[model samples]
Target: MTNLYRAGDLRTPDALAKVTPEQAGWTYSGMEVFDLAAAESVTRVLDGIEGVLVPLSATDVTVTVDGDRHRLRGRVGVFDAVSDWIYLPLGSTVEISGASGEVALCSSRAEVRHEVAVVAAEDVPVEVRGSGRATRQVTNIATPSSFEGADKINVCEVITPGGNVSSWPPHRHDGIGDCEPVNEEIYYFRMGQDDSSHGHPNGLGMFRVYTVDGSSDETCPIFDGDVYLIPEGYHGPSIALPEYPMYFLNVLAGPLPERTMAFCDDPAHHRIREEWTDEDQDPRLPMTSAESRVS
Candidate 1:
């Protein structure tokens, strides 16, 4: 019944973390984080799922999908820069091999099969959201607006600089209010030590999630590799401790006839958006970009 999962609680020999819809008691979203050694490879059969392969810390990654191979120019860490990603359609065979570091396989169940597509880091859209302390960088790797190749899967990464917050106003995509889309979402987190260039496992952050009826409320400290599931609720204010930047990969999916990221903000805090108009965006914004990853 808990929404938060610590890194230590979900470790396997080859994976740093793994979650399936069946495991989370949800219907749409799932993900696995692989920690690969040099020359190591991992294979999986996508029975009824579509997925995006994103490198968390591994730059020398090669993904072979249904006999076609694609190499990714991945960044050193999530905070370092945008990463190249590959999309695998449903009902295919996938093999991922790379030098030492981590990679994430973010997936969603799909009824329709789509074509395989490879996205370079430069092609990924980077956006800055919010203002002042709420400002954060969003790496749109496989969102609905960013990529049209997937049938149901939606993926993105967020970088909340040190001493700031992201995912504000506590929004929910549970199809309530005027919100038309309902989605199950997963947050896979990593923390950076002092700045964007230094990602450390020991860095710390915080996260909060709750329901409107006050049924479930959680505010907990987050560390590298922590995972949070948002089946249905208002979630927000992913807080990065002072001097420790926070990064998270978001994987989302739902049963809607079409894919969308529409969400309804909690009415109580909806007025916060107006306040941001008077504040200037943090200068530290746009923490990472494709050009920064260039070797």
Candidate 2:
């Protein structure tokens, strides 16, 4: 009936690994955030699903997928950090350990066991979406159109600067049609600092979910570490609280083998998409060197 979750409300992983999809009332989709200290490690077994390890704030680390070992670079924060990910195929055992920091193990049920590939941070293509206040940075790292290793997942992230809105024009990817793909989505949020806004050190943001057929709707507060589920409905206009930048990692999957980012924009609010045509992209966007271009 609802699709919003606060950070502390969601189930967290153990000291090493945790699955979040089932905890959020979802099937075969979610991310596991694991923390490790210098020279520490943990092992996770994937029986029927695949895992993608995204470096959140890594320090000298290595993710061993099956038998291959992949090195990792350290990042201070998600906002200004680059991208690096290790892909784990089904029926494989992954051992992750390193100097210190955190990483998100994004997973989804997969029947096909693809080859393991590590996507380096430098290769991530960051682009600008929308214009003016709606402007946000997009990093299409493992989307169906981008990465080919994964057989079922379509992952991406958006970064909205303080006081801005992204995921605008209310869109949905429910049911198969021209642009619709019967997919379920999860939004894992990470907020940047705002000494002028909230007193908490973690940071704050907001997101809205409203049904299209008058079924239901609600807006939820977002803080660092929050995750929201979008089972069905028109969702959009996620807000970054004043002075606090917002970042969200999107995990998507469906019945189809080929994944995509296609969706139907709410017709009632579709006009707003074209109205910003005259304005320039917000200068605050493309917040990091990981960004490649804008479209």
Candidate 3:
């Protein structure tokens, strides 16, 4: 029944973190985070799943799908810039190798196969959302509008500056309202300290998830490398601490016939959207971009 997993709690010998739909008690959506050593390699076969290979902290990574090689010019860290990624189709053999640092394999169950393609960091869409303290940077890696190859999986990265909040107004995509799309979501967090691009273990943040009827409610502190699963609920307000910036990678999937990120906001706080019109967005936003990663 626990939804939050701390760093190292899900570690395996080959991966720093790993989660599968079966392990999460859901039908779709899964992810694995691996810390690779120089010249080392890992291989996986996507039997009935489609996935995206995202480099977390290295620019020299290489991904090979069914014999086709893709060199990814990734960033130094999630806070440093947007990363190059690869889309993997169902029933293909994937091999990840080359330089070091962390890489995330985000996946979802799929029935239809899509073509494999490499997406450069510059090609990813960057959007600054909200206003004032509610501001955050959203890097759309594989959202429905941004990418059309996938049948189920959806992935994105969010960066919240120090003392700010992201994922506000608490929304739900569990088909609770008319036309709401249902999806299982996973949040993989990374917290920054001082001037470091690589996240720190001691850095902290907060997150909350609850039902509208008050049947279930949970709020807790979040740390670097932590993972939170949302099977069903209105979730939001990922708060970054005063001195520690926050970053989270989101992977989502579900049984819906069409892939979508549509959601219904919590009515009580929905009015906050109107308030953002008069407020100025924090200047620290657009924290990371493809141009910023260049040395």
How many backbone clashes are present in model 1?
0
Tell me the tens digit of each residue's lDDT in model 1 across 24-120: 9989899999887733799999999999999888878889998998898887788788889999999999999987788999999999899999898
Identify the candidate with maximal lDDT: 3
Question: lDDT per residue, candidate 2, 225-264, as tens digits?
Answer: 7777887777888998778888888888877657777888
Clashing pairs in 2: 38-99, 83-121
Q: Looking at model 3, which ten-residue stretch has the lowest summed lDDT?
A: 286-295
lDDT for 5 (candidate 1): 91
Lowest lDDT block of 10, candidate 2: 193-202
What's the number of clashes in each of the models? Answer: 0, 2, 0
- Candidate of highest TM-score: 3
Residue pairs clashing in model 1 are none
User: Estimated TM-score per prediction?
Assistant: 0.96, 0.90, 0.97
Candidate 1 Cα misplacement greater than 4 A, ranges: 176-178, 196-198, 293-295
Off by over 4 Å in 3: 177-179, 293-295
